[model samples]
Target: MARFQTPLRYPGGKQRLAPFITEILEHNDAVGWGYAEPYAGGAGIAIELLLGGTVDHIYLNDSSRHIYAFWKAILTDTEAFCRRVSRASLTLDSWQKHREVVRHPGDHDILDLGFSTFFLNRCNRSGILTAGVIGGLNQVGRWRIDARFPRNELIKRIETIATKKRRITVTNLDAEAFMRDRVNKLPPSTLTYCDPPYYARAKRLYLNVYTPDDHVRLAKFIQSKLRRAWLVSYDSHAAISELYRKRRQFQYSIQYSAIQAYEGTECFIFSDSLKIPRDSALPYIAQALRQPA
Candidate 1:
């Protein structure tokens, strides 16, 4: 029932926003056009669009080599990756070993580290590579180490994605480089949706965090360098509002869970090439429904 295309359980993933993005793609006459994500950590939204047949192609890029290798493995080494997933031991000891691999990911091969990244992600709380394991070491909590990882179901999702490998492009590049080198080369109809590292707890939550200056540079570059249709999503941080104060913007909220107040609210800024429905207020996309004209 869920559009569970991605195996990675990313914190603050935009799964609920897939419908809104679909609206953006269709409204721009860009349906079946190229879609891209520069900070493709879990790439939940991109995978949903691709698997749901809303986008003809999806570009997924991440600056972290481990993250990139994880996606690269999914697309290129699908069978082996699925095999590893099917047989991965979900014990805390196994998690510890995979954690070591993630720590010194440089020592592992592309596929090995990729699987390890996936392993640690699924086993860790919130899918954060560096976070502690679920249910704690005692394993006496409400959940356990294997609570999130239904290996059988995970393989199905991975295999389903692999069937469309030719339609998915995976890259390892910094956000700025990806924007300039890869996305800019795509067709003009391509629409890139950027979810940069959120504003708060980013340093602790992500492998890479951007400085205030980096965020400013990104905003400037998105406004100036890129000509294709694009949009950026950031937490409703006051600084972000000021950064994109001149651009077309709106407040967005996820209606799925009332408990996750941490990442429930966001501010979206779009390029002048695209239009946000004037009648639509907060929380733009719901259930892949088309927005108002």
Candidate 2:
């Protein structure tokens, strides 16, 4: 698969991990099956897997209003969304303008807010909406603000993704609510990918920051409540390691971005029923987090 089938450049996005995920789906004979992501930040893996024909249908949900609006508009109002993207002004001035639109999205329609969010995500550092431009405000840095916001390519991605509107289900729902209301209804053969906010760095990275207790609650729900075959990814942290210490888990490092790129450790926990692959794909050398005691 071509690297980065999605338009957005999300920090810690799992576009690189698509191959490993594909291998897992293949190992389990889950190709052409239903796929889901409850905390669908950028939906990198979901987008690649579905578009590459690894899965026939995919479900994506995010609690963030702007994220939900963005996905909704992209699928439902494809032409208008692409037009908005095509016509976007790529400058520090336009970045500030879009920032305001993103901050006060209630005043505008979903499509407008969605496009503004897209604009900021592309123009800003690490695709973080709250972060600043790709280069400094003076535009004297190595890259300009428009360096990443390639209008034509991004528009093509939007249009292409919109083509699969029928096969994609997008929603604005809490992860717990999504599991209860949406995922519970999918076929037993479905494989759900749960890439939740990194507990160690979520406060700085996401608007919907999770408390320590919230992490515990999510762990309980995933271990006890989620009935279908599911896999979860999280930045490695002691708390998270403790939470899934007894489950089937693997450890590896990924290139994560905050203000800059850094090698960050990550862990993947699989449900009890699934078979762990004998080895992980390249670029992600898997080591056992710990064998279940």
- The lDDT values for all models are 0.83, 0.85
TM-scores for the candidates: 0.92, 0.94
- The model with the greatest TM-score is 2
Where's the lowest-lDDT run of ten residues in candidate 1? 280-289
lDDT of 1 by residue, 1-293 (tens): 44567888877777767777877777777789999999988899899999899999999999998999898998889989998988888898998888899999789888999999999888887788888898888887888999988988899888888999999898888888999998898888799999998786577678889889989999999988977898999877889998888887766565332114453567788898897644332234431124321
Tens digits of per-residue lDDT for model 2, 1-293: 23587877778888788888888898898889899999998999999998999999999999988898899989999999998888877877888888898999778888988888888888888788998788788888789888887788888888889999999999999999999888988999888899988888877677678889988999999898888999999988888989988897777876676677789988889998777677665645544422332
lDDT winner = 2
* Candidate 2 lDDT: 0.85
Error in Å for residue 22 of model 1: 0.7
Model 2 alpha-carbon drift over 4 Å, by segment: 286-293
Provide the lDDT at 238 for model 1. 84
> In the order shown, what is each candidate's alpha-carbon RMSD?
3.2, 2.0
Error of 1 at 233 (Å): 0.3
